[model samples]
Target: MSFEERDHTADILMHIRAADTIGLFTDAGHALMKTMYRGPARPIEEVSVTITGQSLEHLLHGFLSELLFESEVQNIVFCEFEFQIRDGEVRAILRGEPFDPAIHGGGTEVKGISWYGLSIRQEQNEYACDVLFDV
Candidate 1:
């Protein structure tokens, strides 16, 4: 799993790649965490969520948006995840600890996932996408 960031005018553009569906989404989650928080994130708490979307791009957007919302509301930075997708439904188990400024702060504040360049594609054995994150 790998992702790279490009500086946009006022936001961050990320291109993520992985070998499979699970890795693609998993790395995307990590990308979000890496953009928003930097710390020794441990699995102190576990949370589960279900999200539905019409397509893979929608699912990815919803998943990332949900992570941002969860971090703000729960004061957590999720670093671990288990994802399962079927029939346009996604189930995820997220694990991380509550936010601590001393440990989990000081990264770029990602306001939201942008829709402008959001896309997903698969080629042979790899999956990749371009995500523009609003900062």
Candidate 2:
């Protein structure tokens, strides 16, 4: 489903489930979908997160990595996420704060989100994806 056409809760759940499935095989990835508000978008806030999916690892890493990408590239906090996962690919509409040294990670730099070490396959009506985060 498109980010605009998805149910927030369902999208988050799917991402989590996908991450969890990956965790079952290995602990090298995370999945997250969130939309930030209060900063640029309306009704969203910083330090806010909505976790979905049954995959814990994917949810965690995906959230953080997306945050990392925002901080470094966009110089935003991106505390909120509007998430959708389809065919193993996650589409997120993120909103958060601008770069602040206080919230930034120390001595840790996120390389990027990689298609490597990951897979997305269709399983009936649902899409399954295993993604690896580059830390």
How many clashes (backbone atoms < 3 Å, residues ≥3 apart in a chain or on different chains) does model 2 have?
25
Please give, for residues 1-135, the per-residue lDDT of candidate 2 as tens digits: 221222332222222222333232222222222232122323244443344544433554455565655555665644344555444345555655565455443433445554443444446654454443344
The best candidate by lDDT is 1
Please estimate how well model 1 matches the true structure, expressed as its whole-model Cα lDDT: 0.89
- How badly does each model clash, as a count of residue pairs? 1, 25
Off by over 4 Å in 1: none
> What ranges in model 2 sit over 4 Å off?
1-70, 83-92, 121-128
